[model samples]
Target: MWYYTLNGQQAGPVSQAELAQMLNGSLPSDTLVWKEGMADWLPAQDVDAFRNIEATPPSQTNGSNPYAAPNSIVDENIKLSGTDEIPATPIPLDIGFCISKSWKTTIACFGAIFLTWFVYILITSIVGGVLSTIGTAIDGPVAVAPITEGMTQQAPFLPSHNQSINQQTGTGAIIAGILNNIFTMFLGLGLTLIGLNLLRGKDTNLGQLFGQSGTKLFRLIGASILYGLMVGLGLVFFIVPGIYLGMRFMFYQTVIVDKDLGVIDSLKYSSSLTRDNKWRLFFLFIINCFIVLAGALALIVGLIWALPVAWLTLLVAYLYLHDGERSLAA
Candidate 1:
């Protein structure tokens, strides 16, 4: 089967013979075509299989081909402008395509992504452990009292050493959690940017994971707070609304990192990009959850592969919806 672009929209999964017939003296030489296993779309003339299919003469009228398959516009909302301008409307989300491409991407660049993730995990673990140790030192040790017959028979009211230890540990845990969350937000922005670069067939490295700073970082943090609050409030008020808003604004982080938009603008852009695709996004989320669960069941080692695939899948979907598949290619 094969697919081709017609009038800036994808069309057909037609047979080879049909494709040849459609191209012979009908479509232009420069029409883009793609099929499974191809890294990216290519001009009809550039693909050997279609080179034999003579293109319509330039002198002839460039009218629509009667034999051409009907346009299979992926998303009616998207209007391709044939340039680098980002689409203001949402594009189609093919769950299968996203997953397959993401898996391939993960395999292709596993070393870089895995190394980056491993470093992040190591840093967070070290920080958490240090804080916990400090808390333990501050609390000291608890002594256990031997059980006596009289003590067992009577109800004794006294402050427990366990309570004091817990209080001190809790305070340290609170501080650790705040610091961890702040670091995660910044690192997460870098990770999203890395994922985007990987999807676009660009080179990436460990340095990419720490490239975030300045106004973009601040904007991402701001957007994260607003996004969390809205979804948190919605979830608090109504379960359904919470789920809806979660899906709608899920792309805010990517928007801020990718487009450099302000906090509110990023949230609004994400909401717009997700319109008409909430159900699809929900289904994708469910699929990723299962993937992560499966990874966890595999003694947690599988997460090294599963997590990157899941994140790349999301980045692929973002690029597809934001600028069409063309943006996915270098």
Candidate 2:
């Protein structure tokens, strides 16, 4: 609650609560001031700022009703009332700030697999040499013995086209493919850990990102797999439920990092936090995501610059978020 007696006219005695109610946009705090040895007005903190503002006792009223204050009156609420005007804040392309960085951080974070798994890929090829591998996918048999006929379609899913799998020609390709799949399968944890490190304002080189990320790797992987299955289940209802769950647990990374929550706990905790704030958080993603798009439109070059800056900016919020924990622990 604040009061301003402007230019000795005793104009206010404005209440901060009333201002809070009236403010539809970002309200700068430095606008108010305190006066020394003066009740009416003096530049309490600075020369240009307004002064002698007093906090109206929360229980008191300044108006005739004795229950409500003067600025509590509807028309006087805004500096200009009854006007359809947007406040002077930015258009707030929310996602523009960080989505790319999240991806980049994850990419860098996951760079360790390429570093660590190359030798393993070579070893697997040598061990599996001349072995006939048969697998049932959409095709009846994706086998090493080559077949030219059209692949059989499977039940409960789409049909496979005629594609040959040959041990002789496709072996290298197949090994590379398998290794790629391994990287992708483990991607959930790698990305989240690296992204979380990025969120914590840490340098996410291949080693640290992978190492720190490994702390929550398996747990996040399981959570991601579960989230995937849940999404698949929920999407049968045209995605309403899936969307709800996504927003609800979207903060799981933060939970995992700051609170040291396990994957499942982070998911549950995020869902709880977003119970009421889902739409707002979801929209924040949509708005900030545009910056990512703009970067993509600029080609990979723009992405190189936009990605880190945007990620660091969002990390600022994450930093503030964990500050409470830091303070409490301190």
Q: In TM-score terms, which candidate is top? A: 1
Best by lDDT: 1
How many Å off is the CA of 157 in candidate 2? 23
lDDT for predicted candidate 1 compared with the true structure: 0.73
Clashing pairs in 1: none
Candidate 2 per-residue lDDT over residues 1-330, each given as its tens digit: 234332232334333333333222232222232222234432223323222334232222233321122333322212222111112221222343334544554465444434433333454455344232322222244433343456454421222222443332355555555544444444433444554555555555445333435566556566767777777777777888877777666666655654666766667655543444466556755645665677788966665545444444344334322221221111
Q: TM-score, each model?
A: 0.67, 0.43
lDDT, candidate 1, 135-181, per-residue tens: 65655654444554555434332235555556655755567666667
**Sequence-dependent TM-score of model 2:** 0.43
TM accuracy, model 1: 0.67
Lowest summed lDDT over 10 consecutive residues: which window, candidate 1? 76-85
* lDDT accuracy of residue 147 in candidate 1: 51
